[model samples]
Target: MGRLEIKSYEKIKEFLSEEHVGRIASIDENGYPQIIPMNFAFVNDSIYMHSYTRGEKLDNILRNPKTGFEVDRELEFLPSYFSHPTDASQADTLYISVVIKGKAVIVEDDDEKTLALNGLMKKYQPEGNYIPIKNNDLVLDEVAVIKIVPESIKGKYKIGQHLRTDSRLVLAKKILKRNSPTSRQTLKVMGFEETPDGLKMVDEPVW
Candidate 1:
């Protein structure tokens, strides 16, 4: 909940890779928030997303590059622990979230665009057959690519950071032993490890 107190930026970076599909929030003409689910590549400590030739998100970024993105994972029911009426405090909910704020700049040069697209492919296509990205494929004179230069990046992992060592061990065991969707992800979810590469989280790097 508070400002990020996690280990290192590498941890945050890994988390971003773990959670590749984040929502990009841009400001509409009337100052409303426009969020679109996007597959992003975390490289060089920055995030990049591709876009079609035209759209509202592109317009908003062109008008104002400042934007915010968020991705989160909740692991509350790892044990299905429900608070008893005798307990006064609320039940526990373990979770983690990442927030990034930045100014987006559309890649202007064709070479840069191609490189960005390749980076994106490498991120998602670690195992898929290689398909060279040509400027003609997507990046044309009209198509737009947004490189999100993060002004600020943060991660809040509320998975009992304050819990005593014993409680943490208990949680870890639960994560390791359980078989549900959230629990099965404990190793990667708890920062103990990362999901393997070649995971298809995005189509291409647009920016």
Candidate 2:
């Protein structure tokens, strides 16, 4: 119900690193925005993504480097009845999101490309089953690494953190009762800890 801005830079970076997919927007020849959802890695204060050597998104970026990128995780969906039995307007969702305005460029340096690709592999495949990437690898010729240097970043979240203590506890219990796959993580995000007694508010929401 309240607009809670996430002001912590560390938390924003954590969220971005954990989120599986991010949407990147690029302006087309006709000035329309073309958006694509792809896997990403956050490394060295920039966003890195690997793609085929040629595509519409690459074309757009070459024409105009300005871009927008976003990553978000939807934690829970609270129905209208959670607040009011008959008013649909009371429905709300819990989520954490980050947005960035940046300039994108196709990475040209071999060592940087190797670093970015290896960073992505580390994020997506932490098991260490594959060989590390090298600058001189022939595979580099087939893949294009896009780097986004962020000009501005903003993060926001909503999880009943603005509610009174008692009201927030009640909402947490309701979420637990529903017991969806994301319930525990959602409760954790809302600052609840599980104990033998039940869920307890141990701290403020992390983001």
lDDT assessment of candidate 1: 0.70
Question: lDDT of all predictions, in order shown?
Answer: 0.70, 0.93
Model 2 bad stretches (over 4 Å): 1-3
Candidate 2 lDDT over 131-151, as tens digits, reads 999999998998999999999
Give per-residue CA lDDT, model 1, range 1-207, as digits (tens): 443256467778777776658899999999999999998787777787778878999889989999998888776554334335456455566777788899988778887777777778887778869877886664456556678888988777765456555565556655555556665454444444323641121221111
Worst 10 residues of 1 by lDDT: 198-207
In terms of TM-score, the best-performing candidate is 2
Q: Please count the clashing residue pairs in each candidate, in the order shown.
A: 1, 0
TM-score each candidate.
0.77, 0.96
Worst 10 residues of 2 by lDDT: 1-10
Q: Which runs of model 1 end up more than 4 angstroms from their true locations?
A: 1-4, 76-89, 134-142, 173-179, 187-207
Give the lDDT of residue 80 in candidate 2. 85
